[model samples]
Each structure stands twice: as structure tokens, then as C-alpha cells.
Target: MTPSEYEHEPIRGLPGDLPPGERILWQGGPEWRTFARSALHTRWVGLYFAAMAVLALLSGSMGGLLAAAASAAAVTGLLSLFAVLVARTTVYTITNRRVVLRVGVALQKCINLPLAVIGSAELRPLTGGHGDIVLVPNAVHRLGYAMLWPHARPLKIGRPQPMLRALPDAVNVAEVLARACGAIAPIAREDAPAIRPAALPAQGVAA
Candidate 1:
């Protein structure tokens, strides 16, 4: 995953230009440190390794202790690198018409959730104004949890919800989305149908 993968994009986060009357409201990627802690579970991983190291130390073997320390360092380093890649490659876009997740590590993919298809949004607040906003798609839209992975809500494979992970100033972003959705509430209630997977822009399997 590298920045060059997305350098060819016409717009910063979107796959293509927005149609007339549709405009971007807010755009941002995850804060890498917050992402590491929340999505990557770095703290839990470190604690697990620390427990292993302690157990190894209690066994009274110098080799075991060294091995545990090395394993912990290697895993932590890899996770840190992955978190950085996720942050760098991802760009969450909120437009007047939809919320777009520009995600992927090696093969970039875009998930577009039109406001009409969005049933509701939930915010999970975190420290320092960083948080996650999970979007619940209407029952008709079936997004694959595996495809969305870290960008999808954890353990929600049955009904995958696209998440804007570890976003900075997520409250403001959520409010913008609310207002945008509110603007079309009446029209959506009467005529908007969930977008089919085939209709999604730049849809592709991602890891």
C-alpha cells in the first residue's frame, strides 16, 4: 500500500467527479495512532505479549525471555506499519448525497453509500475528539463484511455496516452527514431505494 496507488484519482478521495448539485461536505482519513489503538487493537496485543514475556521470565530461561521480547517487538512493529498504511491509503468522503469510503491496502477500492440507502448513522466517541461513525445501510443493500474488513464494524458480518474509523473531529463530520441526510428525508421516504452492489462506483474486493 503506497500513496502512489491513489495519486491518479481525479478528485482526492472519490473515484470520479461528482455530478452536478452534489458536492463534498467533509473529507478526512483516520488518525493513525487512534486507528492503531482501536482498529488494530495494538494495546491489547502489547498486553498479551507482555503477559507472555512475564510467563517466560517466570520459567527461568534466558532464551525464552529473549524470544518473547523479540516476538512482541516484531508483531508490534508490523501492526504499527499496517496502521500507518491504512491511514495513508484511506480517505473518507462525505458529500451532500453520500458517504464514500476510499479504502484498501494494496488494491484501492471505493464504497459509496448514498444518503438515500443509509438507514441511520451511529457515532462511537473516543478521546481527543477522534471517533467512529458507523453507517447502517438499508436492508436491501448487502455489503460483504470480508470485503470491507477493518472499514466495517467488528463482528458484524451478518449485516455489514461501513464505518468511518478513527476519524478526527468525528462529531462535526457526523453532524454534516445528518444535515445532508435530513435534507432528502422526504424524497428518500417516498422514492429512494437502496443502491444495488452492481450500481456502486468502483466496487472491488479489498483487504
Candidate 2:
């Protein structure tokens, strides 16, 4: 869908009993990278089968080789299916008041942290040809399980915070959180708090 369509949809929930100044700033899904399968694994699988195909062609091993190829294809197909299933099992949700992550298809696992408890939010880029977001916790809490393939910012909710991975447009996600929590812009390191502009010193009093 287009960005306009996205903008039209109101931020997903009702305004609760929060103070009047509080507002629902933004809501979004994890980044597109979260949906990608490991390129290394997929490439290796393809190479192995390509070699098998070439060997079969050269040796004229028609019947037996064809059967072997079929078996290999079936196995590869199953692997692809499993990868999709895993991707679908992961989900991330961010709200003005809290962040929620859920994973697992058969048995659901969930982690939730309130924004009030968040001490800081950090964004870590996934290097080494992988693009993912890692969020660290700044305060102590049980919602410390890291989320792999997340589509949101790397946030520090409570101590031992869980890392979130695989979000799309992570930088924008981070900005939304910074504004919502009244935090300064995110920095390279997790420990540094966001810096806000200090008030100017009082001007000399007029006589």
C-alpha cells in the first residue's frame, strides 16, 4: 500500500486514561529485512543441487539420478516452507505506552514492556551483510528476551532489555520512539542517553 494509505489509518488503538498531554504518536511494523531468509544457507543449497544436476547430465545416469534429484528437490522445498513458517511466526507491535513482541506458531511466546519503564532506546545496525535492529534494555525487568527479525527501533525498555531484529525503515521507527518518550536522538552506543537542548540562561533582568 502507499504511504498515504498508511497515513490515513489512525494509530491503532483508543486513547486511554492517560494525561491530556499524552498522545498516540506512531505505530508500525518491522522492517522488510526481517522477512528475508539467510542468503548463505539458500545459496549453499542451490549450489549443491546445481552440481548434482551437472553430474547427472555428464554421466547419463538417467533413472537413478533423476530419482536422486527429485528427492533433493523435495527436501529443499520443505526447507523453504519451514523458513516462511518461521518468518510468519514472528510479530512486533509498538504503541505509545509500550512495546510488544510475539513469536512461535504452535505455542505463543510474548514480551511486553511499558514505555514509562524505558530508561533509554539504542539502535544497533546489523553489519556483516545483515541488516537488523538490536535494542538493549537499560533497567531491570523480565521482558529481556531479544526479538530476531523485528521491524522496529532498537529500544532499551528495562535492564537486560531484549534485542529486536529485522525491522524495515528502522531509522524512522527510532525517531517515532524518541519523540514519544521525549528522548533525544539515538546515538551509536547503548549507554549514552539522548541529549536535549538545555534552557538558555535567564537573560539579565531589565532594570
Candidate 1 RMSD computed on C-alpha atoms after optimal superposition onto the true structure: 7.6
Give the TM-score of each candidate. Answer: 0.88, 0.49
The residue pairs that clash in candidate 1, if any, are: none
Worst 10 residues of 1 by lDDT: 198-207
List the global CA lDDT of all models. Answer: 0.81, 0.47
List the candidate 1 regions with Cα displacement exceeding 4 Å: 1-6, 190-207
* lDDT by residue (tens digit), candidate 1, 11-69: 98988988999899899999999999999999999999888889888989788888888
Candidate 2 lDDT over residue span 1-207, tens digit each: 112222232333222233454444553333333333432145467678778877887888786578667866876777666556545555555555566555544444556655555555555433342334334445565553243222333343333444445455555556555554443214223443321112111121111
Q: What is the Cα-based lDDT of residue 89 in candidate 2?
A: 54
Could you tell me the TM-score of candidate 2? 0.49
